[model samples]
Target chain A: MAEKPKAFGERYMVKPGKSFRLADCDPRAANGFSDKDAAKADTVRDAAAIDALQDKLYAEGKRALLVILQGIDCSGKDGTVRAVFNHCGPIGVKVQPFKAPTADELAQDYLWRVHHACPPRGFIGIFNRSHYEDVLVVKVRGYAPPEAIEKRYDEINAFEKMLSDNGTKILKFMLNISKDEQAERLTERIEIPEKRWKFNPSDLEDRALWNDYMKAYEVALTRCSTHHAPWYVIPADRNWVRNAAISRIVRETLEEMNPKYPEPKGWDPKTVKVV
Target chain B: MAEKPKAFGERYMVKPGKSFRLADCDPRAANGFSDKDAAKADTVRDAAAIDALQDKLYAEGKRALLVILQGIDCSGKDGTVRAVFNHCGPIGVKVQPFKAPTADELAQDYLWRVHHACPPRGFIGIFNRSHYEDVLVVKVRGYAPPEAIEKRYDEINAFEKMLSDNGTKILKFMLNISKDEQAERLTERIEIPEKRWKFNPSDLEDRALWNDYMKAYEVALTRCSTHHAPWYVIPADRNWVRNAAISRIVRETLEEMNPKYPEPKGWDPKTVKVV
Candidate 1:
């Protein structure tokens, strides 16, 4: 077989239709990076570049980027958003966290709400949790029949393909933390009085389902990885590395896309007269 | 007749029903602190303490703190939030920015939406621009009849008193910036390409009303700085000093509230048998 791609992004991108196991990846892998301070500095540099790209993306006004962030509990999803996009203006980026479906949402098909939440052209929409919940939690909790939930992998691929065919570029990240890392986080939340508000006893219930969640994620990441839209299984055990790795790819992707501000048709600024 | 209170808190507190001119206060006042770096360090230190206090507030679960931040454009309200509360968990503090009222919000009594957006028990609610806009914007722009707008001052006092009579404590801050400072900020927003999104041509329209806004603010600050919900006109041209001053007052207020974690009723650890 051809040697697997092993850089910041290509290493993390799940191969299409291959026998993939999430457990095969180490959560502590730094993608050849070792120095946290250096990684942090690089991330900051990338954030500024991301800001420049976002400026072009807004001025171009023809394409959108949808970043889907899915993770188990205590996976640092919100932290990633703040760190990676800190330099980006709030007006240019919209973070739509997909909480439990509301009554209005439950009235429609599963993808109906997801469709409405997609980023409009010239904007970046970040989904804290996303449509994949139909496969992950919905399947793990038996919220739907096994056959019905199993069909969603194909449905999701189709949905994402449609998004790509339109002017949207999609990047999905599974913020993968080890079971032990999660335990440390949960314990810290419980032991530290200041962190107690973030602690929920029900999170322990989810912790008990760790193996089941891992399996669900493995299936989703493997089955849904596609050319049109790909899933990146980000090792999130270290915040610095996770931020650096994701920001590097995000900046690289926007550079690849190379959006430009459109000039008005047959017009020059000097030719226009003010009243 | 009385010695004027001049510590950080009382120095800036707007005296109720007294003649107040925002221009009379210097935006450069650092309250004797000359070191900007030291003030920033202290602000971060106090932010951690605020986090501890917030933990107790959550555990007590019977009271709320509402921080009202009002300012002209480019006065660093959002920056103040990040500086002061970045250490506090997102679960503990919620920021609600009151933009131009939506159609549904405009249909109700002005305070109706403001009341709906109040912090729940155990949460810190930061209002970026708040109900004071009724007096500030409504009065200055002639959005309401002169008699109608005149009555809103007393109405707001009553509304806030009701909130205080219930379990909420309110602290309002007017981020006082000089016209020169605002001009510099507006120019930077216009000149910086990445920040161009935040620059609206209509913002200049608001700038033209600077003198009217100052007058309106003087009236509101004097009339509405009641014992229930007092206003503080902070020296906001210096970002570090603004943050330090606000952090000092917030940490002090929370310390005074002195919330404590509730011990579980009738449940002792010694007698419980492990399964």
Candidate 2:
């Protein structure tokens, strides 16, 4: 009974079965943080904490932490990763960035690549974009029929629940950026010489249907946010705010898990000596 | 041509179609470096250089580096990874450690799981152990018939050639440690408090067949070392020497690749402005 209660981001968690609306969450909200520099400092500390905790988790070698980041273009998925995992060693963490499904991927069920990329035990996996895209982008673009899309919500939920049951703790983050914020970011990508390579014209098409994507995201967040795997809608308009919030929650969740390095069996350290 | 020649570790690479002998290689040879401390410093610098080159490689997203490490138990495979990749980010490097094939993996051809785990473009994939095991352990243990074992060398060579044709550069290392050194390391594993968890009683069984394993390695290396995918025999009696040699070779290979940040297409940064 000494173990801490399971961690949940009550501040941003989309309650299961609740009436959810994307518009109700303000993308620019800073969660009461008025100072940008101060929030950035907090994120730095949280990142270091996550790095330390990850070592213990790896040494324990019993479970995994799967962090899923889902957002529209220019919402800063890559930026969040750089900010939050800057201190974490690459040894125990893997970042799997999902793009449009390849021909091989399309042949399999939607979750095939996803299940394959799930973090092995004792590792942390970051999905830059994830299975939720099957419900979000695929739904908004009508890549699948309405009936097929309807079935995916439960299917994804069940898939994730199974992962949770098998010792993978899942944290889903919806990087909720306002359309105006996204427009500025997209424009910045074109203007900045270093960022120009990332500015794809196709992103403009996705921007055009922002409202439809929002509704799709709303359904995904509402239906898939279960007790085992919750979705936190991060206010990602400000880079510092987004980094601070996600890192805080991630570090807190890892601390709650409280993984410990296991003791060696059938060997007495007092009697053993390297010669 | 302005490009430098493709990098090869002339010191250790097994020459194709040449009379080869594993016995001719000294497991304790220092490769001319006398000072362990000096060698360790070189490895540190090489690790940093590798880290910087890896960023450009990831940016280029054109090819992959597959490093295969093969050795008997307690041969310092894990130690080499830690020393060489200390500075590289997890974003661009993936370490896939192969243990015994599971039921699902055994259901497919031996290379099925290996192909599935091949690094995608712009990443370095380290196989702690690899497909070479199918020939080595299976051959020495007599798990397969002599004819079957004989055919695998050619099958593996053809498979590796196909991979090289498609942009995967392969480097294979056999961590050659002396029987005396192996005994010391095995004893140390049992005696050291931190390393006790790694000591397995079954490793002793393999040690008993050291001569057989050596002959098997001799045949495989002589037959399968190809132009596209070369095997290197590393003297691993000294940890610092192993790290320095491997890191130097790896850095040279990456430098030869000389990956660049790709130019953006259809976007003019000079005219673009954030609005």
Top candidate on TM-score is: 2
TM-score of model 1 relative to the true fold? 0.77
RMSD of 1: 5.6
lDDT of 1 at A120: 84
User: Tens-digit lDDT track for model 2 on B91-139?
Assistant: 6788888888999999998889999999989899999889989998888
Model 2 TM-score (2 dp): 0.81
Q: Write the per-residue lDDT of candidate 1 for residues A83-159, one digit (tens) a residue.
A: 78756735467667787899999899999999997988988778889999988888888888998888899999999
Worst 10 residues of 2 chain A by lDDT: A1-10
Distance from true position, residue B250, model 2, in Å?
1.9
Model 2 chain B — which ten-residue stretch has the worst lDDT?
B1-10
Clashing pairs in 2: none
TM-score of the B chain in each candidate versus the native B chain = 0.96, 0.95
